[model samples]
Target chain A: MTFEKWMRESLDRVETALEHFLPGTDIAPAKLHDAMRYAALGGGKRVRPLLCHAAGELTGASAHAVETASAALEMIHVYSLVHDDMPAMDDDALRRGKPTVHVQYDEATALLVGDALQSQAFIALTTAGNGLNDAQQAALVRELALASGSIGMAGGQAIDLESVGRKLSRPELETMHRKKTGALLRASVRMGALAGATPDAAALKALDDYSAAVGLAFQVVDDILDVIADSATLGKTAGKDAKDDKPTYVSIIGLDASRELAAQLSRDAHAALEPFGARAQRLAELADLVVNRVH
Target chain B: MTFEKWMRESLDRVETALEHFLPGTDIAPAKLHDAMRYAALGGGKRVRPLLCHAAGELTGASAHAVETASAALEMIHVYSLVHDDMPAMDDDALRRGKPTVHVQYDEATALLVGDALQSQAFIALTTAGNGLNDAQQAALVRELALASGSIGMAGGQAIDLESVGRKLSRPELETMHRKKTGALLRASVRMGALAGATPDAAALKALDDYSAAVGLAFQVVDDILDVIADSATLGKTAGKDAKDDKPTYVSIIGLDASRELAAQLSRDAHAALEPFGARAQRLAELADLVVNRVH
Candidate 1:
């Protein structure tokens, strides 16, 4: 399939899978369920799931396990966004071109929604045994937990909150983004690869390198878009970093230098995939998509 | 061993195990780490861990696996309390006789702390294979997720929130409490039972009965205490449930009937344990403690 066709199909699959895994609104606690579905089902680039499928294909992993794991990753991502937008955190009023969960629901419901979504993600992940034995399932859960836990996304968020209104050096800024966004992206690649019957260590290492590079590149692009794109295009507030007094690549290293950094990371990502040769074409295409997207 | 000595020692063991499992203050993003430690290590009854340990002992489960699983359950419990005590939720200022997490730290920190604690819990539980094989570990994760997810504790809390300032029938109140408190308590017992090398279906069912009864008994006693106890004894804001117009067993069925219900549940808990005979001596004592504790 063409890369565009492949990407479109993967996004559709992930959206459908997420809908299947999420509790129905008709169930009890309909309000919280509605809020969770509202936050998770909103249209956004299913970038993590796309990365997962690309890596899974290279490793000859079962498509079913990869899809389930991808949905699981998206749930964690959605939960983070829901919690991050709460009044106690970023206090944002909007997300994905609509009202944030806390704004649409009460702050208390938003909190529970985040909690429940995170719980459901773990539940979804345990079903990855289609091509995997029990050990692989445990490994997948452990890796996702590591990526989502204190030293990963949550810790990075803490650093972001602490650094607001303060000048941070380029290295410090990269460190924050690496944890906040990069960790889950990296896990997405690794998790899909893990479902394969045999995951070659060298190939896994190469994929790790590719994931790290793409993760950083994605953040660099996000920083760029926050500066150049309007909210209508970005689906979130434009220039939110500056308004929140949060440091970003554009603020710390200049937009020109930031673009150069993204290009360099993209090149690194491409180089890391040489181990897979033709098998990694989709991943290379994905790297291009991340670095080149306007929004 | 005397039940008192066993109870005291298990509490001590769990406290130390939790300390070992929690991230040290030296970790980067020390503030979030510190807040997690503060919320988790701060003293409480350690009832869930005690329940987990008692259940784990029945089938010759590994001590290491039991301790790790116990810590994981406690982490989830602590995370729930941290989030539930936030200004947006219960708006409580005190817990365990001290300032709540959101009060001791900023709201953002409290939010991150809860998020991190939950992530760490999943990570901790995956270590169940120290005695359990990979399959058992997977089962443990699935069970805990079911207990913690939207249809469980979070769902129950949603019901509680909606029922505030409004009357709920006895059955409605029971359903809410079953999800809120009973689910986790039952999960505590179920997970520990699962740790055993050979868990028979009949024994598991009986334990489930025992867990359900004790779970409701715990909450019924809690509701009774809320009405009659003082804050100094409860280590929380006693009478706050009625003050907030929240429905409870006492509120729905009256205080005297609530006490009778607790006693009946305790008897049922003991009867369910007849299958284990003398092996469930500790659980029997735990049932007595739950129904009889002053606070």
Candidate 2:
């Protein structure tokens, strides 16, 4: 199948699983339920889910396990977006071409939605991992928890909040993104691979390298798009990061250097995946898709 | 040893475990880390941890497993307080005789602190539960997630938020508390029991009944205390629920009836523990502790 066709099919599967996992709008706390669905259900590129499925292909993980893990990863991603767009955070009014959760609902609902979405994500992790044994399933939960917890995504966010408008050395900025974004991205691959079969340490490390590079590349491209693309194209307010005085690759490094860095990371990702040869074609394509968006 | 002594010792043990688990203030994102430790390390009666230890005694579960699970439960409880105290929620400024997290730091820090504390709780669950096998460990996570997620604690909070200024029937209010406070309280017993060993279906059901009754009684006493106690005694803003127009047992059924209900619930809790004999003596004491506070 063409990459587009595969992506469309994968996105549909993710949406269906997410809908199945989230509480219904008519539930007792109707407003909160509505906000959870609003934050998760409708839109976005499903990039993290796609990455998960692609990596799952390497271990020949069962489709059921891949799909559920994908949904859980996407749930975490969406929850972060909802929280990030809150008035105290980025204060963005739009996401994926629609009103953000806090804007559409109230701030309290938005906060609760993000909080509930996170809990639901962990629940999803427990729901399925089709071929995994009990031990491996426990490992999956542990991996996701570590990635999302204080030293991972939330901690990275704390650093981001504290560092606003301050000059951060390149190493410091990279360290922040590695924990904030890199940890979850790496886990998606690890979870997918573990769902079917555990890889040796060396192979696991390679997958980690591949994921790390792709994750960083995706962020670098995002920074590029935020500056070059309009709000209509980005589906979010363009240049908001710079406007808010948040450091970005484009600002810390020049636009030319940022673009070069994204390309270098894409190359690194492909180099890490080289051992898998034909098995890694989709991963390579994803790296290209993440980096070549500007072209 | 006496139940009171055991309770005090257990509280101390829980405090130590929490101190070990929470990130240090010297960590890079110092403010967020400090807030998490502040919210969790000190204050409160450690009621949930006490319940966990008491139930763990039934199966003779390892102290290690019970302590870790107890700490995780307390973390979840504390995170809820931190978030609930936010301006968008309860608008409280004091908790446990100190400024609330939002009051001490700022709203954004409070928000991140809550979010990070929750993630840390799940991480704590994964770290230990020493006696539990992989499958059982997975179950521990699932139980905690179900209790903390939407349709659980967060869901109950949403109901509380939306129902402010709105009168709810007794049954409606009971349902809310069952999810709000009751779910986690019940989970505390269940987790403590699960940690040491698994009980048969009948014993498990009895423990559930015991926990449910005790949990309800605890909340009933809280409502009474809100009206009768001073802020210094409660270590929180007293009577805020009524001032905010929120429904409570006292408001709906009158103070006299609320007292009667608490007593009846305490009796039910004792009855549920009859099968455990001396093994359940501490649990019976806990139920007494919860309701007797009202008197």
Candidate 3:
């Protein structure tokens, strides 16, 4: 299939799966469920789900397994964003061209929404008939928890909060982004691969390498976009990182070098999938998309 | 063993397991880790863990399995408390006779701490060497997720938030407490039973009955203590429920009826354990303790 067709189909699958997995708004505590659906349903690029599906193709995972894994991955991503936009965190008002959960619902509802979403992510994974065996289900749950917990996304966020108005070395910034975003991105690939057949050590390593490169490339492009894109284009506030005095690649190493780094990382991601040959076509395409997408 | 000695030993076991399962404070984003530790350690009755251990006895589960499950359950309980005590929620400054997480660290750190602790709860279940098979592990994860998610603890919390200053019927109050706190308490018994040998349907039903009664009794006693105890004795602010105009058994049914309800629930809990004979000794004691404890 063409890349555009594949991306569209994958997004459709993820959206449908998320709808099925999430509690209905008519459920009790309807307001919290409403906010959760609002935050998770229509938003952002769904890049993590795309990566999960793409990586699953190489590992011969069933479509059902990949679909379920991707939905769970996306839920975690969306929950993080909901929490990040809260007043206690980034204090943002806009996300995905709409008011953030905290602004749309009250802060208390938003907190419950984020908390519930995180729990739902695990529920999605452990729900029976997801095409994963018991071991795979347990492994995926562990992978997600570790990737999003103190040593990963949340820890990275804590670092970001502490780094405001302070200078961070390039290495420090990279480390933060690796934990903040790269951890979950890498887990998407790993989980997809694990969903069907277990990948051998070399295969796992290759996929990890591809994910690490693409993940970093994705962040670099985000930094570049923050400087060049408008709020309308980005679907959220633009240039806020620099305005907040938070260090970014463009701020620390200049815009030109950051773009070059993104290009290099994209190339690295493609090279890492070389062993898989034509079977990795989708993964290669996704790497390019991460690097070259306008927003 | 005497109930006191058993309770003491179980508390020690849970504390050590939690210490091992939680990330070290020296880890990156040290402040968040510190806050997580502060919220999770050194306080509360550890009632959920005690219930887990007691239930595990009836099913012949390994000590290691029960211990790990208890830690995960306690982590979930503690995270809920951390989030519940936030300014946006209860606006409480004290917990466990010390400053709450948001007060001890910053609001951002406390939020991250709660998020990380939730993740860590799942990690504790899926971690290797936890004496559970993959199927058992997956089952436990599902139990925790379902009990804590939108339709469970978080959902109950949302209802509580919306019901402030409103009159709720007795059944409405019962339903709220069942979800907010009862779900996890029941999960504690179920998970402990599953962690060892899968209980037969009859045994599962009996355990559920026992847990349900005790869980309600626990909440009723909490309301009683809120009215009668001081902050020094309760390790938290007293009478805040009535002061905040939140519905409670004491406010709705009056103190005499509430105490009678708790006593009846305690009797029901003991009756549910008759099927297990002497095997349910700890569970019976726990039921009495839940209904009768002063603080």
Candidate 4:
């Protein structure tokens, strides 16, 4: 299949799996469940889950395990976005081309929604009936928790907020990206591998290396797009990062150099998958797609 | 031993165990570790952990398993308190007789601290040396996630916030309390049993019944203390719940009726423990302590 077709298929599978896993109670507080669905189903590329599936496939992991892991990762991504768009955070009015959760609902609702999503991610991983033994399931839960919490996404966000308007060196920027984005991405691969129970030490290390390069490349491309893409195309304010004076790869390394770095990182990411041979084509394509996409 | 003496001894053991579990880590941005420890060690009654220990003992679960389960439960409790104290949540300036986390640090720091505490809780459980198989570990993680997330404590808080100033029926109050305070308390017992690898369905149900009754009784006493205790003695703002116009057992039912209800629930809790015979004295004492405490 073409890359776009493959991506869409994978995302559709993820969404269906996620929806299936949600709490299906007929309780009076239907609104909470509604809010969760709204935030999760709101359109965006299922990059994290796709990455999980791709990495799993490359390592001979089962599709069912990959789907569950992908759904969990996507839930975390959705929760973060909902929280990030709150008035106290980015205060963005739009996300994924529509009103953000807080704008669509009240701040309290949005906050609760985010909290629920965060918790639900773990619940999904814990409850997934993929025939995983307790130890492997516990490992997946640990990976998700570490990836989504402080010293990971939350820590990275704190640094990002603190570093706003300040110039950061390459090492500092990389550190921020590693926590904010790389941690979850790396966990996605690790979770998929764990779910499949195929993540031997060497495979795990290679996936981590692949995840780090792709994660950084993902951020660099994002920064480059903020400069090159328009608000209409990006679905949110494009140049808001620059307007807020947040440091970016394009700012530190110039647009051309940033592009070069992203390309090099993409190549590194693909090379990290060398052991998987032909099974890694999709992941390689995903790396290329990360750097080359417009939004 | 008298209830107070037993509690004091149990608390001491829990504190010592906590310190041993949370050995100093060298993860940089050392503040990450500091924030985590600050929140975790910044004292509370350790009621949840004690419950886990008591339940574990009743089930003949290992002390090591009990300690791990207790530590994880305490971490979740601490994380909830930290997040709930944020300006956007309860806006509290004091907790456990000390400056609330956000007040001592910055809001961002407190947020990250809470996030880290939560992540560390699951990490602790997953990495626990309890010798349980993977399935048991997964069950523990799942239980914690359910108790802490939406449809649990966070959801309870949201509902409580919305219900403030509004009169609620008895069932409504029960539902709120079940989610807000009871879920984790029940989970504490459940986790203890799971950690013990004692999968006796009947005993689990009995403990659940015991936990539910004791959990409500605990809230009743808390509500009563809000009315009768002073801030200094309670180590928190006294009568804040009533001041906020929040519904409570004492508020909805007269004080006399509330006390009667608490007594009845305490009796029910003890009756539920009858199934475990003499092995459950600690848990029975805990239920008594819940209702009899002055603060």
Per-candidate fnat, comma-separated:
0.88, 0.66, 0.96, 0.59
DockQ of each: 0.85, 0.74, 0.94, 0.61
Residue pairs with clashing backbones, model 2: B61-B196
RMSD of 4: 2.0
lDDT (10s digit) by residue, model 2, range A78-137 = 888998888887789999999999889888888888888888987877764444566766
Q: TM-scores of the models, in the given order?
A: 0.98, 0.97, 0.99, 0.95
Q: Name the TM-score of candidate 3.
A: 0.99
lDDT of each: 0.88, 0.86, 0.93, 0.82
Q: i-RMS values of the candidates, in order? A: 1.0, 1.2, 0.6, 2.0
User: Residues A1-295, candidate 4, lDDT per residue (tens digit)?
Assistant: 7778888888888988888766654653567777778888847878899888887776667777777788888988888888788766777898889889888877767777777777787787788576455666788887988787777887788778778878899999999999999999899878877777566788888888899999999999999999999988998888988888989999898999998999899889988989978877888898888888899
Better structure of 2 and 4 per DockQ: 2
Q: Give chain B TM-scores in order.
A: 0.97, 0.97, 0.99, 0.94
Model 2 per-residue lDDT tens digits across residues B102-202: 88988888888888888887787776445567876777788888899898999999888888999999999999999899999999999998887689999
Scored by lDDT, the top model is: 3
Give the CAPRI class of candidate 4.
medium
State the lDDT of candidate 4 residue by residue for B125-203, as single tens digits: 7774654567777888899999988789877877887797799998999998899899999999898878775758899
Which residue pairs clash in candidate 4?
Answer: A134-B134, A134-B135, A135-B134
lDDT at B83 for candidate 2? 88
